[model samples]
Target: MRILHIIHSIDPRSGGPSHALRGLVQEQVRRGHQVSILTTNAQSAEPWMPDDQFRERMNNDPAFSGAELFIARGYGRTRPVARFTWTPQAYRWLRRRLADLDARPDIVHIHGVFSHLTTFAPRLARRFGVPYIMRPAGTFAPRCMALGRTAMKRWFTTLFVAKDLRLAAAVQATTPAEKDELREQFGLNNVVVIPHGVAGVKDAQTDAPAARRALNIPERAKVLLYLSRLTPKKRPDWVIQAASKLLSEYPDLFTIFAGPDAGAESQLAAAIASSGLNGQVKRFGFVTGDQKRQLFEAADVLVLPSQSENFGVVVVEAMAHRLPVVVTPGVASHIYVDASGCGLTVEDSVDALTDGIKKILQADKTELGQRGREYVRQHLTWIVVSEKISEVYAAIIRNQRTRRRNRSVNQQIRLTTK
Candidate 1:
């Protein structure tokens, strides 16, 4: 089957959705499907790279080389969040590219909403009589919609996104909580709950002492990692506040913020400095490859205090590394954590998060980590997730075939009667 993924950006720092897309694409390719991605070079402000440099890196990057990548120009860019455009050039590029495809894709999967990709790409797929699925990727969650520029988001959704949601073959929610949010709050049917997959665990054990030494973390320190963008919604400041509260109780605790800052660096820096927790709270910007692995190995626990997350893929990543997780209730994966008894779910508040961290720290760390690892192994690996998604694609195609057959039979009956 030929699968085309339409997304705003593929930059890893773009967070869970981008990482999920990369894993899905690679796994699908391995499973004998033709996969292609159409995306923009849109990136956030911090850790800035010139457009040409970024594009060159992407093109030459081995991970991206597995699938054909189409990078379109986005308009009206700003720091941290670049608005996707409906420029004439973009439309022309998409149309020409679709025309050039040797075979129309069996399915066009649009991976987030409120962008031109969500509003326009599905229509383009429709023009070629292809089915498309829209995965809002938690963008439409009730709390998620309440964040920055609410009025504009409402306008965009009403004017452009709602129609697409109604038109899509299915709207994917990564968890049952999200499914309920979409159905009850947004009145969306055809909602499918398929959680994102994690890359298989490469090696669960890292040389703990060596990793700690390399990262400059003291041997006696207990590491708590927050490994996502420093965006407002992610509530990195909450983690900082929580760390401040635990300073007296866990003096050796080191809370490292390790990800690209998506317009929240200054705020986080101030919070860390003023709270008198500078020595305890460290920021390591963005990490990948081996550096990322070492951090995971060195950490005793992973924390994601998001105000709203459709599916916290980082939680899965942490669990795969056999690191216990502490996540907020807003995270959809909190259900798995709760059910599997592998992590703690706290309210999205400083006190609640602080308490959760303390509880995990005092518990048997080895047992908790092992439980989380077992849960991920059972349910969150790429092969298992890709198979489920492939089933959905197959079902949609089969339904389309049946509809065409029924129409053909009706036409034949009319001709015979005439």
Candidate 2:
């Protein structure tokens, strides 16, 4: 299958959608499918690069090997417009590709909403008689819609996104709760639920002692890891508050805050200082590759106290690393954690999170971690997720063919009658 993906940004620092797209595309390519990506050169706060350099970097990057990448220079560097991803070059490139019979995609997968790619890509695909699927990637979650330029989002949806969504062959939701939100909020009935998958599960389990030594962490200290973008919505402060409460009880307890500062770094730093737990808590900004693996290996439990998450990919990553997780109800993966009995799902409160952390610290961590690993091995691996996504693509293509046949038949009958 020739698959095309359109996303605003594929930079790892941008967050979950980027990481998810990388995993999905890599798996699809590994399965011998032709995959292509259209994206802008938006790498968080970094200065935008020219298209040629961006393409060269992406093509050479081992993470995206075996896939064709198209990069366009994008504009805007501030809030509201930062994610707009206005790329006329990408728009023109997609238009030309759709117009070319040889280059036309069998299916186009558009990721995220409220962006130039998501808004315009679907329209182009439809114009060329190609089917496309929309994956909102939690953009339509109630909490998300309520936060960050709510009025503008509502306006954009009504004027452009709603029609784009309605015309999509299908809209993907990473969790059932996100599906429910799509149905309830937008009245979209074509939503399909597919969870994000983790890659490299077998190699995820690293040597804990070695990792601890590398990070200069005490071998016997109880570690709680908060690994996600330090955005306000992620509520890193809540984790800090919860950690403070548990530190005295578990003197050996250590908390590690990892990931890029999205907006809440100062607040989190202040919280840590005020709580007087700065000695017990450490902030390691934006870890990736081996450093990320080490953090996972050295941690006892992963904690994500987000205000909302359609799917916490980090939660699954922690699971893949044989690390038990403590997530709040706002995290959609809480259902899986609860169902799999791999971790604890606590209410979205500091007290509840503190107690949940304490419980995990007091409980059999090795057993809990093992259950998480087993769950990932069985259900959350990219090998399994890609298969399900392929099925969805095939089903949509088949339905499109049937619709075309019916249209052809109806035209023939009208011509005969005339």
Candidate 3:
């Protein structure tokens, strides 16, 4: 099947949605499906100035090798305006593809909401009679809706997004909670639940000693890792406070904070200083590729106390590395953790988070990690997820063809009767 994905940006720093899209696209291409991506050249570091090197690397990245990529020049530097990502070139490119019989996509996959790409891509797909699936990626969740320019988002949804979502061939939700949010917000029944997938980890345990040495962490130390964007919603400060409580019990405990600072570094720093965990907690801002893998290898457990997470990809990634997780109920993947018996799901409070971390520290971590790895292998790998997504795409396309055929048949009968 020919699939086209439309997203605002492909930059890794743009967070989970971009990374999730990359994983899905790569797997789809490997399965022999033709895939193409249309996105703006918008980087989180400098939105107005497009990074030529980043685009070059992405084009050459092995993960995206079999897919066609189109990156249009984007406008707007500020957060609010930047999201609207004025990319006239993307509009033109999509228009041409939809008009060409050979170049037109079998289906279009639109990611995220409240972005220029999401706002306009579905409209074009509908205009060209192409079935399009909308993946909200948790934008409609109550917690997400409360963040950043709520009024503007409200207006945008009412003016444009509502129609686009309602007209989509299907709206994908990564978890049942997200599915509920979509249904509640839109009063639509076309929601489909499909979780994000993670790549398998190889020799993560064998590499732990070397990973610890490289990071200057003692082999005997018990490491707790916070590996997501340091945003306020993610609540990295909660991790710091929780760690402070465990120091007396676990004297050799160390905490590692990974990922880029997204407006929460100051709070995290203050928490570290106040708790006097300056020596115990280390911040490795924005790790990726090998560095990220090493962090997973070195850590005994992973914690993500986000106020709301549509799907915590890093949690599954940690599980793939045989690292147990402690996440809040707000995390959509907490259900998987609970069901798989891989980790604990606690309330969104410092005391609860502290107790949850303590339980993991007190239990057989190795066994817990093994459970997580097995669960991910069985149910959350890219191979499993991509197949489910492919099925959805195929079903939507088949239904669309049936509808068109019926319309054509009815039109012919009317003409013959006349």
Give all TM-scores, in the order shown.
Answer: 0.95, 0.96, 0.97
The C-alpha local distance difference test score for the whole of candidate 1 amounts to 0.83
Worst 10 residues of 1 by lDDT: 79-88
* C-alpha lDDT (0 to 100) for residue 279 of candidate 3: 94
Tens digit of lDDT per residue, candidate 3, span 1-418? 8999999888887788888998999899989999999998877643323378878977887768899999888887677788888888899999999999998999999998877777889988999999999998999889898998899989999999889889999999999988888898889899999999987545535479999999888899889999998899999999999999998898888999998878898999889889976598888977888889889999988999999899999999988888889999889999889988988999879999999999998889789888888888989999999999999999999999999999999999999999
Better of 1 and 3 by TM-score: 3
* lDDT top scorer: 3
Going through the candidates in the order shown, the clash numbers are: 0, 0, 1
Order of all candidates by TM-score, from best down to worst? 3, 2, 1
Clashing pairs in 3: 259-286
Residue 264, model 2: Cα distance from true site in angstroms: 0.5
What is the per-residue lDDT of model 1 for residues 1-418, given as tens digits with 9 covering 90 to 100? 9888988877887888888998898798888888888888777545558989988887776666578887877775763246555444556666765676675688889999777766788788678668889998987777988887788888888888888888888888899988887888668878998999998866536577888889888878988899998888888888888888888988787888899878788888888887776587667877888889888888988999988888998888888888888999888888878877888998768888999999999999888878888888889899889889999999998887788899999999999999
Off by over 4 Å in 1: 79-81, 87-90, 97-101
lDDT value, candidate 3, whole model = 0.89
Q: Rank the candidates by lDDT, best first.
A: 3, 2, 1
